[model samples]
Target: MIADFDVSSDWHVAAPYGFLRGLRHEQPVFHSPHLGAYVLTRHEDVRAAYGDAKRFSSAGSLTISRSLTQATRDRLGEHGSFLSSFVANVDPPDHTRLRRSVSRAFTPRAVAAMEERFRRLNEDVLDRVEPDGRADFVPGLGHIPSTKLTARFIGVPESDEEFVKSHVKDWFMLFLSPQPADRQLELADSFLEYLAYVDRLVAARAAAPQDDFTSLMTSLIGSELTHREVVELISTILLGGNDTVPNQLGNSVYRLLRENIWPVPADLTQNAVEECMRIDGASLGSFRYAITDIDLHGVTIPAGALCLLSTDSAAHDETVFDDPETFRIDRPNADAHMTLGYGIHFCVGAALARLQLRTALDVLGERLPGLRLAPGQPIAYRKSIVGRGLPALLVEWD
Candidate 1:
């Protein structure tokens, strides 16, 4: 049954609720052959599942596509101890410790201080596009600010900025598609290169630290995290911080332009970003392996079962948001949407993402007053079930 759903064309649409809505209504814990796991779709059920991490563990493998080759898994295994350092892969006490190490960096005070830098970065990227009057927003302006900001945040040298940005797409793509062996090896090489770069950054911070995430990480150098754990944590930060924001930024702009709203108002752009995330977030859903059998809505989810919490469905739940299909910027409850997962695994970088989106829109609107999508060109979407965004969004202005 799971395999059947996996191969279905509808799977591409993501919100498979149109097909599985009945199952969710009758049996919220139906087994999906495609995923080879039990899917939890209802908003309430997913919320419950997310809140009770004790019942649904996060320690195991957590991707939907069960087709990942053993080679891919093996490559991931190279991290070994580092793998457990990422907050998403741990449970409870460990997750708490890892999350705290970097929590101060994301506080309201810290993010507010970075607002001007974000604005300046946004303008700098837009300036490059202004002269062309046409540009590929994703790889062009869209990726710049986040890449620059993330590098700066981690205290990585400015010289390595371009090198780091160049690999962001490829690194993200490995999980998005099944690439040729050579391409996979190249990505693995890039991943290790990035790991080494971060390791050096960590060491540099320890030797001569500054007020940055790297410095904060350095403070924990002799604590619970060892040198390898530090490297993994930094790698996780780079991976998480790099791709998602840029994609969200690009996708939000693409969506606004596609809807014929060029030069979207900052407030509206912020709203649109929220809606896009709710509608088609980069992360399709987060995975958790069931630690024990649990019955939900008349269906039994067995122990060791992989349970998926559908963020897309939860966002569109009619009970939660009225007229879930219609994309309205003025929707009152738009802020309540959960593109970021709920409960324990809720995205720690949510504020950073919002800042990027808000800054992007503000700068673009102010600088490119006439920005709009090119009349006849089709916007190309990145091909990935795990995430969604535009790879190239060509646009022109008056």
Candidate 2:
């Protein structure tokens, strides 16, 4: 029966729900032809997989499509492992060290210091939209704030602003879908270009040493990281900041508009963002590899088997949440959503993402009080399990 199942279509349509129901009712640990991995769908099972990093390793090629070429893996491994130091791809000791190196810059104090700057930037974007009373919120407002904030964090000059934003989106897209070979090479080229740009910035920081993250990272240049490692580290920072925040902002607006809400309260916007991410996360699930044959909730998952934790389903589990299908801003446990992930590999930028989302909504509410979706137009959904969001969010205000 499982052999005939169309895993791709099933995953594409109902997403984690399709897989979750199957796992809970029929097979808790079953192989998926599309992902070529064993999917763990139940909330308890996903939580177990997340908590036990020893039993479930993250240091492996963890893509849904098992179609990656050996050359691609070798290329990634050689360039100081573009996928490695990002914290999402590594295990304990190294992950801990790499994360700590940049953690100082993202502290609450540092984040709070930028509030005035963010407010100004947000208002500037809002001003452009106010005159027109309608705009594509993603590119116009949503993408700009996150991209600019990340640039500030890395101390990349505002001159290179457009350059960074242009390439970053393509980098995310490559991870989402199987693009053509030329497009793949173009994506890799864009990444290389960004890395080279950071290299120059790092060198400048070493000479002049400004009071910014670039200087902080540059201080460790000779001791902790080589030139390439520094580039990869900054690239990871840019990628993380660039990829998710815009989607969260866009998804938040889309949800609010869909539900026919107006003057979205600051608290409601926050709740709506959490619920939307829980329901349609930028990432469908995260990947792990079983380190040892282990029995979880009566299901035996063999060693070296690829594992998928259905986070979307975990957030919507009927056992954990009441009326899981409803979008309730007032839900008591709404903040406990799993979109940022859980346990060892939880999103390091969770706080930053939240701040950006909050700032966007706060500014939008203040400037565009009557914001609403354009009547009868459909919001386009982006295709990618790693990141799910609207491609565009069209809105109008009087």
Candidate 3:
């Protein structure tokens, strides 16, 4: 009997590469009833699909919960009103305008200017951890710096950094579905609180100018944006500035420790960072809608069909990288990994993230060369249909 792909199976999330290996070999384009989105597993197909944005429009509900998958459809239903104001939902001319407006802030030069500050902050985080010799790297060291950077970029005062970071972390979990309904409802509360927080920041910035993204937004387009739009955009960047980086750093560190690759060679640090992402990146996949009928490797994806571009699987595609399962920081093609994606929708914060990761590896190697996962502590991953990350990563050093 032939076995069809099951995206929601435990094997897929916990040990996805084994299952993804089968996917790339046999079913490059699969539509699972459980997932509802057409899964593109190979690197070439995924990149091509991403490039053909006209057919694979990103507009619509970007949730990973296959609401059409029976039980989810009945329980959670679908909420389309969520991102009407989100910048990610916009396409073409508007995407062009909004991205251009903020592009100046995330440029390589801009991010470079701010590097020393964050480097010092991350180093300080590790410095404080050195005394303990053992620390929960996730929130202890990871999320803290991201929270500070979020405040720095958003132009908010860091007085309530801890308070806001707590809420932002909660808000970040909203993207992950397939969890209990109770957790979903709780996240709703956190989301509202965060929105209110951003709203207050928006109002405060409009009243008194500050040198930050908030101040920049209030003056854009003759200040024609509604209060609602400003709130939505700020919330969007809050996810960018707070959510992804923390988990990414945690995940990267987790990979290094698990593979016994700590004190990684200096020359291979950059390649190691990319290799970690190639193995298991923070993002599970991104969502796109088939605006028109599309054909893939003998499968027909009907118009309006939801598409899950499995970027994780793409990195594991054997044709793209030799011995894909092996973690080799020396792999020269590590930069080709598509976790940040390609084409017009490539990650805007790539430079900042790379800078942070590069700096983080440097600090870890320098400060605690003997870093290893804490003994006897069970590491846990926060499951999300759209991403993968550790809830806590405890580590110790000699």
Task: Give the Cα lDDT of each candidate.
Answer: 0.72, 0.72, 0.75
Evaluated at residue 359, the lDDT of candidate 3 is 79
Model 3's lDDT to the true fold?
A: 0.75
Instruction: Give the lDDT of residue 113 in candidate 3.
Output: 76
Q: Give the TM-score ranking, best first.
A: 3, 2, 1
lDDT of 2 by residue, 1-398 (tens): 34422434434533445446656667867777666677776777888788888888888544334333455444444542355555577787776776677676778888877777777888877777689988888787788877887888788788888898877666555554577665666676676676667778888998999888888878987776566556767777787777778877787777767776656776677776677677656666788888999886677878888888877667777777788777777777776667788887777778778777777778887888888887777655665555667667778889
For the record, the alpha-carbon RMSD of candidate 2 to the native fold, in angstroms, is: 2.8
TM-score of each: 0.90, 0.90, 0.91
Ranking by lDDT: 3, 2, 1
Which of 2 and 3 is the better model by lDDT? Answer: 3
Which pairs clash inside model 3?
A: none
lDDT of 1 by residue, 1-398 (tens): 22224423545543455654565556566677666677776778888888998898888443334334556557757652335556777887878877777676789888877879989988887766688878877777887788888888877778988777666555555544567766776776676676777777887888888988888878887785567667766666776667888887777776676666667765677777788676656666678888898977767788888887866667778888788777777677786666777887788888888887887787887888787877787655555555666667787776
- What are the root-mean-square deviations of the candidates from the true structure over C-alphas? 2.9, 2.8, 3.2
Summarize candidate 3's per-residue lDDT along 1-398 as a digit string, tens digits. Answer: 22544545555555768777777778788886667778898999889988877788876545445223333233333332445555566677666766676676676777897778887888878778789888888878888776788788888687866667777666555544544656656665666776778878887887887888888887663544556667767777777767687778888998888899988888888889899888878887788888988888899999999888888889888899999888887898987888887777788888888887887888778888999988788765665667778888888888
